[model samples]
Structure formats: C-alpha cells, structure tokens
Target: MGADRGRRGGRPVRVGVYVGCGALLLAGCASMPDSGGLSGVESTPRQDAQVRVFAKSPSKDASPAEIVQGFLEALTSDDPQYETAREYLTSSASQAWDPYRSTTVLAEGPNAEAVHSGTSEGTAEILYRLSGSKVATVDTQHAYAPDSGSYSRTVHLTRQKTTKEWRIDGLPQGVVMGRTDFQRNYKSVNKYYFASNVSSETGGQLETVADPVYVRKQVDPMTQMVRALLKGPTRWLDRVVGSSFPTGTELKKGVKSLSPDDRNMVTVPLNQKADHVGQGQCSKMAAQLLFTFKDLTPTGVDEVELQKSDGSQLCVLTEDQADGIASHGTAHYPDYQYFIDGKQRLVRMPSSGSDKQPEPVPGALGDGDKKLRAAAVSRDESSAAGVSTDGTSLYVGSLVSGGSLGEAVLHSQGKTADDRLTTPSWDGQGDLWVADRDPKNPRLLLLQKGAGSPLVVETPSLDGRIKAVRVAADGVRIALIVEKDGKSSLQIGRIERGTKSGEPPTVSILELRSVAPQLEEVTAMSWAGDSRLVVIGREQGGVQQMRYVQVDGSTPVGTAPSALTGVKEIAASEDERLPLVAHSQEDGIVRLSSGEQWQKVVKDGTAPVYPG
Candidate 1:
C-alpha cells in the first residue's frame, strides 16, 4: 500500500545454430542436444542462452592484454571443461585456477588496462587490471548473493621462454563476466527444503521452501541441479530451511552423471552418508529431489529413485508420494482475488478473468459493520485477515458466514492512520503476520492460527520500521517494505523460528536486505514465484515502474508487468496463470489478465490481494 502514485516506487531454445567452431577470437556459437524432454535450459527469443559461447585460444604472438582478454571471454563460454580458457594461462596457473570457485558478475564487460610492464630474469613480465562494477556473485554452491561495489583484479601475464608467447601467470580465482553474459550462461533454479521453524502443532503442514541458485545453462543442468540440492541450501537460507540429506551426503564417488530412465524416473546414487537413513528421512530426501525436478524436466520426470553406495535401493519417491510428504503449493489453486470495496467491506471476485459484480466474502469482514482498510486471504481461501480502516486493529476470522468478529487480535498505539498498522498477511501454515508502525514501539507481530497472544517477532537487523509485510506461501521467506529517511525499499528477509530448551519456539525476521535498491521508494510488493518478487517502485525522481527481482537482489530476465497508473495496492498468485489484480487510482480494482491490458474490476476499490 502506498500513495496513489504508483511510484513508486520462454520459449525453449531452438536446436542447432549452436556456437560456431573454429579458432576465432571469441568462440563461435553452439547448442546442446535436447534429451529426455529437456530443452537445453529453455530461453526466450531475446535471451542468448540458445547460443553457446566458444572460448578461443590466445593467438600466436598475442600481447598480454590479448591473452587476458581471451581468457576472460572463455570464462563466459558453455564449454563444459573450459579447456580453451586454460590455454591462455601458464601451465601452473591453469592447474591452480578454478573457474567454479565463484562467479563475479559485473555491470558491463570488464576493461583491461595495462598496470605494469617489466622484465623479470629476462622474461617479459606484465600485469593488466580487469575492472568493472560488481553487481553480484555466485559461490561454488551455485548460490547467489548481492555484492555491490567496484571490482578490480590484476591479471598477471608472462612471456614464456620457449614459446616466447604471452600467457596469464596469475589471476583471481573464479570467472568474471558482465550481467548479460552471466544470464546467458546460467539459469536460476529453486532447490527445495522443509521449513525449519514453522509450528508442527499448527496442523503440521510440512511445506517446502525455495532456495534459488544459478547453474550453468548448457551443462548437464539436471545433474547440476541435483548436485546443488544434495549440497544443501544457500548460506542465507541454510538456517531457515532443513535438508533431509544427512551431512556429507552426496552423489557416490565416480558417479559423474544422472539421467532419467525409460519410466521417466531419475535414479540418484548416494554415498554411504545417506545409506543408513530410515524410510521416513530417505523419502523426504526424495521428495526434495522430485520437487526440484518437477519444473526442470517438466515433461518426462515422474519419480526419483535413490540408490545406496553399493547400488542397493535406499528409497524411491514418485511425484504423487512426494506431495504427501510436503505441500509445494503447485497443486493448490487460488480460488479468488480479494480487496476492500467502497463501503470498506472485504469483497472478492473469482480468480478467473471475470468482470461481473463482486460479492462479499462469507465472514465478519465481509458483512460486519466494522470497516476494514485492507485484508489478506489465506492461500487455501478458508480464512481471512483484515486491518481496520483506522489501521489500529487487526482481525482474523474464517471465511464461513455467521462467524462473529472477535476483539482486535492486535492493536497499534500510533495516533494517526499512517502511523498505525500496515496490511496484514497470511502464510501457508495458517499463521498471520503484521507490522505495527507505531513510532514509539514499532514491532512485527505474529499470531499462530490467527489467535492467542501476539508474539513479537525478533528483527535484530531491521534498520527502519516496516511499512508493509507479505510472507511467501512456503512460510520461510518474507517481503517487507521498509520506510527510512523518507524513502521506502523492498527487502527480502529470512524468517527463522527455533525452539529452545523448555521454551516456546521463537521467530525472527533476519537479514533484511533490499532487493530493489535501484528504486528510491517501494510502494508495494508480492511474491511472484518461489524466489522472485513483483515490486512497484521508481528510480529516484523517475517515473514509477514494476518489475520482478530475484530474492538475491538480481533483476530477472523477462518483460516487466505492463504499464499501469496509480497502483495503490497489487495482488498476484503464485500460479502465474492468474491475472494480476491491482487497485489503480485511475481505474479502481483492475486486472491484468494474461497478455491483456488492465481491466477495471470495480470502481475505486482498494487493497487488492490474493492468498499468500
């Protein structure tokens, strides 16, 4: 929710036409073979992922600059082994350099400038500075993290006595490439895990959380993804998500590849670390695999079979069985998109593209005299939470009719509406979360099952008061609009819950980092995918914009939501198939159906929201 000002702040690759072969400066294009219903790490027409990069060996008599440039270019290629990139390096450097150590993505192609030139023991010694603005980095685990700053590295080259050719003698570990090239060579994939801190007594909804990472697009992505999953979640998410695989569990030694069998099941052979696990834990591990692969190998993958170190069956889990172990939200379809209407009544419309008159939900929020300023429906649509018009009270009630509205479950002491409570949000585990904007005692509160005493969530790292809050359906991550110094930014934080000895479990919103640092102020945001958020904000003093940002703070490669004006509140379903619902000042309660413009749903409606 924000000022009326919106402000605020693909198709699979075609086979063939792969990288061209030959000894050119940069490697020619190449393509990967489509196998087992996979489509070469699918990309849209605009993305060059369909085109493979070929690394070119340094030309004869190449200068130090040329050798460094050739080697850097090779790092961006799809070559599985990066052999060509090694040719430009001295024999010892080649063996010591590890391209997979990490990837430092820069704002643009690096600039190489001669930093030093001299002679050491009659052999020509030279050094070039490769510099650019660092945007982010992907670690060896394929996890991504934002690391904004200047990036400067020295590439030392030497003239070999025998060949009299310049070759790189020393360079920083890991590959460096521009953002465009990084996206071309890598694709984001979600590694799944169980929510570590959610309440087991609260219906025990074992849910899977998304831990996104970048993997080489043209490599054996299925295998890479499986390996990443087995390695556990990214560092930031490691504390909040639990992996079923035991520590040190990994693919068996000498097992370098994995493929789906004729029955559409991918068999994974694990080392002894996973051999002693019982049926329950092993099945959970398989569930993690099936969840990660469902979207990856969409067409053929139906099961995940785990084999022990000696090739004996440990456990096998089919997609159907995994669904029983954890709720991934893939099967839950949102029933309706909801909002507060003209009379301040919580109202709803079918999620499908229907423009008929809206109806009030079957609850106190819908029919009671109490006026609500905003509301959040549960993902299952069985319950709803509403914030009073004055933003002082929060109420959670079932969607069923005839239920009486209980006293305010939460309240804020702020005297003004703007200083009171922002919109409240519901997570898949049936818990409700809201932030009180009280100037004297700002706090983020959580209520289990929407009742009982409100628990103050620990947010040790939060810099400013939270103006808005939305929890992902997975119950592991949260999107927050933080207001500070007259500007608001979108931050993605890890939601952690832990139970200490003889005490109730505690919850904390940890590591609140802005995902939309480019936006001067973020007006609204919603979880668009497992690790992506659709945010509405604008560059400092610029027109407001809407775009998708990875939880790791990287802009996604895709078309932004179509332009709209005066978006006060926005609602989106995890099911990308649903139309986007927004409360536009220009056209109240509008819907952006797939491939269609925003259509007015109701006049002057406010606070549109889909279930979390």
Candidate 2:
C-alpha cells in the first residue's frame, strides 16, 4: 500500500537537500526501472515435481577401471550410508574414506576417464582425469562457496587373489559428482541464525538472518542441516553475525543420528557440556533449529527437544514458542505498485480489486515540472527518490502532498546523458544505493536518509562499467549488470558494512561473482526472492528472454515463466507470491499472472517500480 499522507508529514527529513544544476552533479549513477507487481493479477504456483535419483551399484566381476567408474557413479545414489558404493573399495579404504567431507561439483556430461599406469598386471595404479569446470564446492560444514579450476585424482587397485576380483585400495577422501547428478540429489536450504546482541523493540528478541547452504535431499538432511547450524556461520559472515551454539559445543558420543519421532518431534542430544547454558539460551538454540527445519518436509518439524548426553532434558520448544523469541523483519509488503505514469508523475496501482486505473502519489513531484526518468521508493514507503528525465539531477522528497520536494540531493558529474545515475534502491535500513556510470569518474555512492554527505563505496574488482544495480531486501547483497569488452554479464557481490568502532557505519563491495554465466548480455534484472533473481538477458546470438537464477550462480530446476516479446524492463517483489510486472514495447505494461502467458494491465505506463 502507498504511504498514508497523514503520517508522512510528521516524519523527520534526514537526507541532504540541494538545488538545480549543482544538485544534478551530485547524483551517483543510472539504473533502469526495477519495478514490482500490479493489482488484480492472479499469482501462479511453482512446480512441485520431485527430482528423480538414479541408483547405481558396483559390478561383481568387473575390471578395476569398471569398478572405479561404478563407484564414482554410485556416489550419486540416494543411499544415506553409501552402502552400495563401499562395495568397490577395500575394507581399509572404505573405513578411511569420508564421503561427507566435501563435494566437488563438476560440469555437465561425462568428462572422466580412467587409465592404468602401473608396471604389474595384478597391481595397477589407475589415474582418473576428472577434468571439467569447477562451478561450486560444498563442504561438510554445509557451506556453498563459488569455485573454479580443474581437478584430477589417482586410485590404487590390487586383485584380492582369493576372489580374483580387483578392489580400490587407495582413493581420495571426499566425493565428486557430475553437475547433472548434483542438481538431482542435492538441494539448497537456508539455515536461520541471529545477530549478536541485537534486540528488537519487543525486547530480548534477536533478528534472524538466513544463511543458504546445500544438503543431500535423501541423506540425513535434517541432521546435516542441524550440524551445519552448530558449526556456525561461514567465514565471510562470522564477524557480523552470532550463533546460539557456543564454541566447543558438539553432539554427544555414540549419538550418530537425529530423526523425527512418530509425533513429529526431533530430539537433539548435545554433550553434557551444554548443561551450563541458561534456559533462555537453550530456547534460542531450539528456535534456530525449528526455523532451519521448517521447510525440510511437507509436514515440517513441529517441535524440538534439547537434552544432555545422559538423556536429561534441557529445554523443549514448539514452532509457536520459537516464533516469540526469534524475529525475521517484516516479510509482509504493501498492497500497491508505484511507478511513473506516462505523464511523468508518480502513480499507484491498487494491488487488489478491479479498479485498474492508477492514482498519482500525493506530493509536489506528482504534479510538477520536475520530469523524472526513473524513480525508487523506500521499503517503508515514507520517502521517494527520482532522477531527472535528462539524467542530470537526483531528488528526494516525501510521499505526502504537503511535504516539501527538497533541493537536488545529487547531480551527475558525467559529460554525457548515458553516464548519469541509474535507478536508486533503498534497503531495510533506509539507506539509498546507486551507481555513477560516467566512464571518467565511475563510482558507487550511498546516501543515508537525513545525513548530509554521501559515502563513496569501494569496488576494487569491478573491471567494467556498471550498467545497473539492484539491492536485495535483506540489505546485505547486491545484483549488478556489468559491461566489459563489449559483453554484458550479471554479477552478485556482498555489501560489507564498515565495523570500525567510534566511526559512522560505512559500506564497501567485496569481490563480485558471476551469476548468469550462460547469458552473454544482461539488459535488466531484479530481486525475485531472498536468494534468487529474475534477469532479462540472452546467450550469445540468442534472442532476449527472462529467467530465474540463484545468486550463487547455480541454475535452479523447474521451468521459468513463459518469455515475453519486446519486454524493455522487468520488476518483482521480495515476496514471491506477488505476480511479476514489466514494460514491453509492443504491449506496454504487462503482468505475468500465470507462468504460461503475459497479460497487459496498462497501455500507457513506463519505467514501473515497486518499493523495496
């Protein structure tokens, strides 16, 4: 819903105010419309088809090379213990090998070949060249990090002499699976953790953060996910977030598994050392597991029982009880879409009933001569930011009618109009982010609401020019469309917050990783959900199209919404349930009500945008 006029006038104005050409020179960069949903559009359900997991086993009388090949194939099976795969290895080798230590995800297709290199016939050293693109790596800690390079391994084999069959005597410790198998057998799941010492207005409640990691679908996923939670956040996020499980905490000896009971309850037995933790701390720990396992199955985990090694109960928590202790900032969004109407005025589309006409947002910018090329709304919908039509000036003002349209907050330093600022994005913290594409003085800038000077963010690894930028609703990550060497690609990077004590909180960009590597050119993009993005791009020599991809550079399963023709810009909400809205050259403002087709909702609107 649009911001209520009565409340907007009462809020304090914190951003810097400027005027005319001087203000235009202060705006950072340019970005296309990252607009969201339209009203009265029916939402479509995502496909729920279960992935097929093929089973493979070692051949009884196969040669050493065939046995090795079969073992590698068996690694992709759904067997939790990998019982069938162990048959191809010797007793000692099987005991030493740990399949869960790490998973090396290789490219699609068969790029593995086994060649004998030993002098003797009975005892041979087989070198397997497992060469392919290394897309990602998943460790035992359940952290999914991007990786690239080549890989190879050698396995020692010898005939048993008694059974006259060859067996693997030496092999690597971890498992390696082809891309196709990895996609089918493994799935990504986000584990929730809380910020250290950060409390909400309700008091004693901590804010929850989602850490996405991959786990085996058929393996003991419930246990694996919990263990990952116990291991804590990855290295990159350790400095910023905290966990309920203290250091040195671990599972009790002789307790090798965890599973839900007939009553849909999971009993977690930690070492006796956890007894020192207070009841409040224990409840927080249970809250993390409850949310982590929320989507594990259709029924989901109803409750979690924490106990000591001696079976002494420490604490018990249900889904309802955990909700009271942990807080995920408002997932609910407003009920209307905001965009620039054909008349260059800010307009609102009622996101519910049959009234399809959009009403101008109440403010000076809504009816004035300040022609805007693009605009963005804050997450709270209290303020609005816009760039002039000629891309020379940037303005920040209130959404209410009586509120003042402040002097230009930023102006473009670029020589040409193409070098001006792009569309601006607001995070949950009320900070606005935008990029300056001027080839001479290209830089990323951050504006704090009600603060005077803007902070210039660092982008050390940015080799090319920034075409557009979109920040996630969580305020931790950003999506970028970068052009280098005449080719455009989609990239994602983390927004590291400056933590130096006694200084204002500043921001910097870490190294960026490519997301849609298959697309040669990315024209427009937007955040579709927490970890996924909807991009408008195409492969080399291919026509423009839109598809959904994960921020980790992995292609998700299920068919994407049907492609639209002449689509110039696209927008989507942080909530996935809302329908997607876009501007098409041929059809004007179009909405994707169902995944199969596009429906035109407005015939005259352009540069559509939604509140963050």
Candidate 3:
C-alpha cells in the first residue's frame, strides 16, 4: 500500500468504462509508427491519431465503482483541459488534485476494487484499492527509469449528504496508467545543458549535453518545456552537467501560457532571481532553452527573449546566437566513415558517399608502416589513435599528410591479445579513453588531448571489470560494458571533474546505472543520439540481436535497427541523421539507413567507425 494523498472524492457516473459486462474496455489508444516493430507487445500504442477522445462528465448518483472507473478512463482521454475527469471528484478534491505531479506506468491498466472501509457522519464510505505491476515512474522532472514490483494505492471515498453520491475523499498524487496509455499521451524530448569545466580550459565554449524527458504530446509543450528547463537537468545527469539558469529561477508570477508571439519569438518572463545575470550567462541560459525547445516543433520558436519580473526585456537570443554560445555534437556533419580495410590499415570513405572505394587516410596509421588492430579518430578528424596488431601498443598521431606515428604512447602487458587493450575512443574534448584488461592490473585510462601520461579514471562503485568504453560526445557521460561472472551488461556513468586550477583535474565515474539489465552480454555499443545508444547484445540463452536503449533504460518504439549476424564492432554518430554502421564477421562492414535494410559496404573491411 502507498501513502494516502490528495483530497476527498464522491462516486459519479462513468463515461466509457464497462466492467460489468466483462474485462475493462480501453479507449483512446494512440496510433503507432509504420514500421511496426515494438520493443514489447504491450508497449505499442493502439489509438488512432486522427481519433480524438472527448471524455464525458459524471452523471448524477453514480456508484463508487463507476466514479473510480470514469476517472481512470478520463486520464487517458484527449480532452485538453481534463475538465471531464475533474467532474468525478468532489469540489474540494477536484481543486486540490494535481495530475501531473508524476505518472506511474504499470504493465497493464490498473485494477480498482471497492471495499467498505467505514462510514462518517451517517454516510457510507468505500475504499478503492488500485493495484497493478509497476513498470516505470516518470518523475516530476519527466525523467523515466525502469522499475519493478507490485503497485497498490488506497483511495478512500465518502458519500455526500447533498447528492448521496460516493466521491473519493483521499487519493494518491499524480496519474496512474498502463504502458499503452503512457505511450499514447507522452513523448520524449531532449533538454540541453552545458558541460562544466571544459570551456574554462578551452576558452569559454559550452558543449551541449542532452537530457531527455517525457511530456504530453498534445498539451502546451512550450510552457511545459520552459518549466522543466527552469527546474534543471534530471538527477542522473545533475552532477556532470550545469544549467545556465540561476538556482530558484522560475516563470514570473501569473505567467503560465508561454506561446511564441506573432514574430516567432518566445518571451519568457522570469522571476526576480534571474533578472540580474550577466549577458554571457543570460545567453547561455537562452541557448539551453533554445536547444530544449527545438524538440517541440520545427517553427514554433525561433528566438527566445528573457523578460524581467517587471516585463522588461532582459535579453533576446536568436538561433544563430545560441549556436555561438554552445556547441551540439551536430555543429559539423562528419565528412567520412572510417574503418580498417583488409590490409590492417586505417582507411576512410565519404560519410554519405554511396559504395565508394575506401581510401587510406593521410596519416601514419594509414601509411602501411603500422599494422593496427583497433583505432579511434578525434572528433575534429585532425588526429587518430591506433592499437598495434598485437593490441599491446597504443599510438596517437595527426591525420594530415606528413604526420608521423612516433614511438608508442602507451603499452599493456596482458598475457594475450584479447586481454590487452580495448578499442580506443575519442570524446568531443579530443581526449582518448581505453580500458586495460590485464589480469594483473586493470584500469580505465584517459589520455588528455591524446598525449602526455594517461590518467586512470576513478570508479569506486564498479563491481565488474570494464569490458569496453564509449564516451558520449558531450564528455559528461560514458557508456561502459561491464563483465562480471561471465556476463556483460551496459552501464552509463557520469564523468565528474574537479575545477581547482594547477592540480590535475579529479575525474571520477559516479552513479553508474545499468541501461540494459536484461541483456546477458553486451559486445559493442555507441552513442546514437543525444541520450540514446545502439546496443548489440542478447538476453540469457537468447540469440544475438541489436536494438536501441535510452540512457535512462526505457526502450523506444519503432527505432530498432535491422538484425545482423556476428557483429564484432558497431558505430553510430551523435548526429542521428547518419546511418548505423557495423562490422559483421560474415558480411564485413554494413550500413543501415532509416527505412532501409542493411546494405553491405565492403567484403573484407572491419572495425568501422564515425568520428566522435
């Protein structure tokens, strides 16, 4: 049982709930995508997008069961204001109810059963037990995290003397629905933030980090987005990313509807706390807002104007101005997708070029003098890091002509090639990361600027040895494959950095959470979008398969790539427009573009990669 919350209620007439005949009927299902492959059968939306559900107001002298059923049905309707849903509650309960505090998603529609709890003031009372298997909870921040266990909440209803109707007097905060209804009502949007400590070292350029959240698809998304942005990033990302908005900043008093004006600009009137920020900090806040609102629509908002509490314009930021303040990984589309050809040398081909012949890069790794086993290219495409064929040596050099691969920068003393160094990866900061899997001394190392002594990253909470590591483009988060007891699962860890000047920055991986707990083994994965990853793994006793999992552990619908066999390495770009590339043992390098099947890129190539 959960805590008792909210106000009293009365039983009223129901609209579409018909449980007496048999099983409960579900209405207002959302239309699904055309591709039709769902992460799970129950998770897919079934409502027609064109069909709008108009909830019916409660009727007089409704039963307790009818009132409870009607409100649950109303929660899933398309009635924008939810006026009909409120009709089921008493006047005081209706006024006190807040449906958006949070949303609890269950594996199926909640089952409400009524039992006589007691009576007060010569009126009968009934307690409705709402129960189901909990799947996830979308917090007030709109963040989603996987959950399990049974859910039970008691809703106490009392009979009214005036109407003789049984209305709920006490209920839990927030709405509760099944997975299908959640899929119909809410959508995922990326909220952006700036990377801390990086601009301090790189001269004041904020790299944007995306924090994804779920919001109602049809409601006033602009206003909801603004409110969420003001609250700050989600808890999982709070330690690593920084928001430009000052603490306690909020929408100005009496400011609710925040639609873009006729001039295509959104004027956000903020409280007194945000009124005194400097121009640079103000622009950074507006830049984060702009990036966050981009997910609302294509043309809803082009500029953001921050207003003081007194309605004075504090600052206005256009799209171009916002870009100058912060850089998303998509600022420059990559020129090529790189890989090691049959000759064990680094090579590249145009990213969008169709079946073009691969060419050796103009670098030491491509000079045919070094037989490499694995490699990584800097985000800017200016440098490359390669591991020797034996996997004991790691070499970093320039990617331009005349660039030389000097002595090996790092070495591993693992007994075998498989136990040496994992494939290296570069972050947007131009730093390199790799895990040394030596049985004698295992460590996760970071090469600052791909040079100097490598720094061993601290991971006090890691229970297993690191199998593979992929740093996110923002450098605030990392995707790690951890192996323990012969199984490997995918985990995301926040990269926290120290700020004291002169001393080497203290870097540690904190709050590690498993994003694919069901998978028995995760062989390879890459950042596919702002907070999504393309993962290659399979469940226990299951066949190998590939799918996309959100950093927060929710599986998105209709976006999984086509199935492939024997995938040794997989690569995806933060720029979601690019196709997914993978090196398959049977098919060599293959690519999967949207709405298309996997196409072969080569017959013998291996280790395909896109510049981070």
RMSD of each: 7.3, 16.4, 6.7
Tens-digit lDDT track for model 1 on 553-609?
887766889999888778887777788888888889888977778787888689999
- Local distance difference test scores for all models: 0.80, 0.72, 0.81
Off by over 4 Å in 2: 1-59, 109-114, 117-134, 145-151, 195-207, 254-265, 298-302, 308-330, 352-355, 499-504, 594-596
lDDT of 2 at 545: 87
Error of 2 at 264 (Å): 4.8
The TM-score values for the models, in the order shown, are: 0.90, 0.83, 0.89
By descending TM-score, how would the candidates be arranged? 1, 3, 2
Error of 1 at 384 (Å): 1.8
Give one clash count per candidate, in the order shown: 14, 23, 14
Model 3, TM vs. native: 0.89
**Distance (Å) between predicted and true CA of 130, model 3?**
1.9
Q: Please, what are the lDDT tens digits per residue for candidate 3 over residues 119-186?
A: 77777888888888898899888999888899888887888888787787788888888787778777
Cα shift from native, residue 286, model 3 (Å): 2.0
**Full ranking by lDDT:** 3, 1, 2
What digit string (tens of lDDT, one per residue) describes model 2 on residues 556-589? 6657878788777888876676778888989887
| Candidate 3 deviant stretches above 4 angstroms | 1-54, 78-83, 91-97, 115-121, 200-203, 499-503
Model 1 quality (TM-score): 0.90
Worst 10 residues of 2 by lDDT: 1-10
Q: Where does the lowest 10-residue lDDT sum fall in candidate 1?
A: 1-10
Q: Is candidate 1 or candidate 2 better by TM-score?
A: 1
